[model samples]
Target: MFFNRQEIKFMFDENKRLNSKVKEFAKKNFHPKNFLFFSDSGSGKTTIAEKLAEELAKRREICYKSNDSKFIDYTNQEVLVKQELIHNTWLLKELLNLCEKDICPMNCKGKTKIDVMTKYNIITAQDPFDDIFNFKKRIFDENPAYSKDKRIGLHRRFSKSKDYTHGYMFKVTNRYQSGKVDFQITCLKESDDSAGDINDFVNGRFDIKFAEETTLEEAKKRVYDDDFENLYKHKGDVFLKREVDMDHVLGGVICDVDTENHTFSVYNKYFDSEIPSTMIPPKDLNRLNERLRNKIINQFGPDHEITGTNKRT
Candidate 1:
């Protein structure tokens, strides 16, 4: 099936709305308690972080670094905080240990932070690309709900004879198509240098991250996606959702909140598919997906539908 513009536009619009809500929160809790980069489904938290950094750019600059810094110790990257963190210094050095400058083709290989940022135009003060591709599989599988934009998808990089993006390369893995949409789903690892760099600079920085055709989940991850889902009350609505019918089961949803204008939204699948019923203690999604488990029946099993229905993966 071709890409649906309405879904993409709708998601983008939700991003704008979510951005406003985040700004409000920033205004309320603008202090340096800590830099919070989070979101549920359509609440572009990372997008906001990049934008905030971009706005901060008016005053300062931004840097991006590979997430490996979190795992590795003794990272050469300046943003690599010396204090004990998620990843140790040895791990950091071990990771970049061999990154050995992109120039040394003989020793160095794979995409660099600069490589990915340049492609995406994210001028963070630190580099965060090297490890981005590392967790591609998990990022694509669990986080972000995406809808490919065909027009832009048709738009190709200057080098490619035909567009060479889609899930295969970026790891978005659109189950709908044999080849997935690259820009459709993105990776959002919380322990990223991008945000850390912003925190490093108390002054902050201005940054614009156009995660075009990607979902907030893929762009950010469970850490922020979880925050985004619960960040709805302030939006002046009750139920807010972003409907995407690209990959995995159904689309995404932003449920439970009596906000103002825009409240709730669900994936095209929920809209397209008829609601299924559940008896007593129904099945969890894990069991349902297991074809062997005749014990599990419908897709919206008890766990996924009633309890675990906040968002779709």
Candidate 2:
């Protein structure tokens, strides 16, 4: 428990070095809004995540506060560590809590708050892909009306546009379960036309210009020929059409930490790619992972497999 001056200095230098490495890693990977940290149950993923979050808070001049597994709040930004899968309902609750506190300075209102409110968030999980997929499913399931609408359905399935800055028009066709087929056009961005279309759709009126049902051939022609000019004839300026996946909507960076190997890697699900791993000092890894294991066993019980195979005797 007692360390000489030299030993104390060595510890300080090592801690500083590790902090620098973590900051650099974050700068390179934390662009997306949603990020994940995955590894073995006792890999110290949460510990590293907390450190990263703290460093970010310091850099962003935000308050760093955490309440166990609930969330590591960093004012506008946060690291979500709730010991459960990330789903729409849970996420909405957490976001509302964050918003209610009015911690962030941004004055977001209405649907935009639900869609693109947060500046950044980190979600800790064991399986990143499964969590991401489940989150998207929850979104669709909870909003059945939106899911059934041809425009929303097609936008959810085929829209790959990542340009969040501009508006968009999606034209597609599908057969309903009632044995009725129709081509539908819808606008995704916030605009007068899109707003009117949404109001009409909600009021049981499909007479809006944007919700017009046309032939499949015509829809294909507009989509394939990049026919924004004709489509937006009276609407507004032309907007680009692209796929907008869930990853884009829930943007963030993901980091996968490997405690056994004393390294951590970053991943951006939107790009579907993995960044290389950065080596952690073995001493730091051993100390953090041991602390994490003990904490997990204490919280979840010794029988929890995360405590590792060698059970306490």
Q: Write the per-residue lDDT of candidate 2 for residues 125-172, one digit (tens) a residue.
A: 454323323324245544322222333422222112232211112121
RMSD of each predicted structure:
24.6, 28.0
**lDDT for each residue of candidate 1 in 72-159, tens digit (9 for 90 to 100):** 2221221111111122222323323122121111111343343211111121112223322222323453333222231122112101
Highest TM-score model number = 2
Score candidate 2 by TM-score against the native: 0.26
The whole-model C-alpha lDDT of candidate 2 against the native structure comes to 0.30
User: C-alpha displacement of 32 in model 2, angstroms?
Assistant: 5.5
